[model samples]
Target: MATVRVGEVEVGRVQVGGGVQIAYARVGHGPPLVLVHGAGLDGRMWQPQLAGLADEFTVVAWDEPGAGRSSDLPAGFGLVDFAHCLGAVIEALRLGPAHVSGLSWGGTVALELYRHRPELVRTLILADTYAGWKGSLPPEEVAARAEGAKRMLAVPREKFDPTLPGLFAGDPPAAFVPLLGTMAHDVRPETMGAQLLMMAEADQRDLLPAITVPTLLLWGEFDARSPLSVAHAFQDAIAHTELVVLPGAGHVSNLETPERFNRAVREFCRAHA
Candidate 1:
């Protein structure tokens, strides 16, 4: 295993399916906890979670394909490909039956993983995510989101800078904004587009009733992007699930309100473990 540090978090890169190398950072030691990051972000997005929860659990965060050290996304790549890669990473790390947590788009990927390999996931921690654009949201809204994303892709980089504030309902951390800007820059345009397309076509509503493991829905109280309605739909659909809405936070709850976010997740994972 190779180790490198992004800040204080020491990360390692490993070659997985089809010569794709996935980059991941880990902390602490206990029952394995794998964190899947949202679209447009790498594993570093979970820095706060790793720092806060590492004392009690083995926290591992990964950079999805084409995001960090991972290989370029090939043609025809979709959610199934992402899920397969997720499984490969878990297998490579030798983390048996881990508690999986995902944020935003990562949440959808988590569901896909569960559908593909039910044996690998021990518990589900989905934060501010939709079942898929088709699963929870209206068709019109999905079309709008897809169009907006495509427009953003066509616009110049400078035009995209002004929209970053929409990610939160309240003022985000001063340093957090710059950190996000840097992360956004690192992501290739192709990766962003592919991830968006995957979300656009994802449909996991049929799989919700089949989820037999413990599930927790962590959401931002004022999340404009995903909204409380989506959380309600997930809670109503999933047979066994609890939803916790963090007050004063937005889409990116972990970075926007790390203390509350960390405490809630730690309590949930521990109660079950």
Candidate 2:
């Protein structure tokens, strides 16, 4: 067993390609556990997990290109390009066949990574994500989400207000709501547009059954975005999958119910390790 020094959160930059450097926050020391955050969020979204689970795993949460401290998206970049960037992050960090976890769009990104390079990923933990809105959600909901993403870019930076209330099931902790606000303020509108476009076109429904790695699905019991039905779909499609529903949690269960989320992941990794 290994443990990390409980101190400051370590941050670094990795150049994915085209002079663009992606940012990541790492903590702990052990087998690598890479966290990919959802759309409109940076690696900061995984701060709770990093803070709690650092003792057992080398947990790293990454900012996607165009989010957090990462560089802007280059010309002609698409979903596959994002997948390759994840591979680059793993390589640059020297994680060595890590356990990968993703939330919301990040989960789709994880699937893309699997599609591009299956061997690099040892296990996958997908939370609050869809195969693609088209792949999993109803057509009407997909269009609505697409429209919402488009409208989000129209929001001015000064007026950038993150919808924190929707992320939790009921009243969230006093601490978390403000954190969401700060993260929302840090979001780059230009990069958000690219992510929105990616969401509109991404479709990983066909890839579900092909996933060969041990997979876990963490669903917020009250998740309105990627609801329980989506988890059912994932379990029905994928092999060697396990699902856990976080009680009293909404879209961002890992943050809303941090202790439960952390415990689930640690036990799963320990079993696999």
Candidate 3:
């Protein structure tokens, strides 16, 4: 089995549906909580949350197929396909009724998991993500995002720092830059394109009402990727859901504001899981 080490977390591979090797890691010990990352980034993005949450709950963060330490992209993989892959991990690890947490694209995957396999999810933490991404971006913004994604994927890994500022609304902590650099390098361009295409085609508005499990909608007040209004719409749609906006935060809330993110997650897990 191949492995990729990042600080304390070790990325290990596991076979999911379609015979794909999904990379994952588990730390600390208690009820299991799965942390999923957004586009371009990998499971390593959950560094802050995994370290903090591991103290009380067993956190298993993994790279989606083709991201980070995961095997190369699989054929015919879509959002629902990604959801099934997670389901395979839960079954393989015997971590049923797990608390599932996802950010941005990761959140979209978690929503599908809950919708299709509610039995696997005990609770959900959907952070800085939207149920419906369609019509959210204006024609200009869509064009810009598409161009930006293309540009991001085209650039050599060493020259990618220019886009870091956009991930965080304000000046980021010094520690984040090098870490992001590592993540940016680990991802392949084709995988980035595939994930972006998945986002472009995803529309989960109709699936919201179907999610009956306890859900927490975590968002950043200044989030550009998923606006506050979008988060509120999720709050209104999900049957049982709560909204928590991180003040002065953006897309990567857990990393941008670790203390607040950890507190909210820790408290919620203690209460619900």
Estimated TM-score for each candidate: 0.94, 0.93, 0.90
Error of 2 at 67 (Å): 1.0
Position 179, candidate 3: lDDT: 89
> Where in model 3 is the C-alpha error above 4 Å?
1-11, 135-140, 147-165
- Per-residue accuracy of model 3 over 193-248 as CA lDDT, tens digit each: 77776776677888888887888888888998788888888888888888888998
Candidate 2 lands at a TM-score of: 0.93
Candidate number achieving the greatest TM-score relative to the actual structure: 1
Q: Which ten residues in a row have the lowest lDDT in candidate 2?
A: 1-10
lDDT of 1 by residue, 117-206 (tens): 889899999999989988878899889878877876887765553243357877867768887877877877777877876788888989
Worst 10 residues of 1 by lDDT: 157-166
Error of 1 at 195 (Å): 1.0
Give each model's whole-structure lDDT: 0.85, 0.85, 0.81
Query: Which residue pairs clash within candidate 2?
Result: none
52-90, model 2: which lDDT tens digit per residue?
A: 999999999988998888888887878898899999889
Give the winner by lDDT: 1 or 3.
1
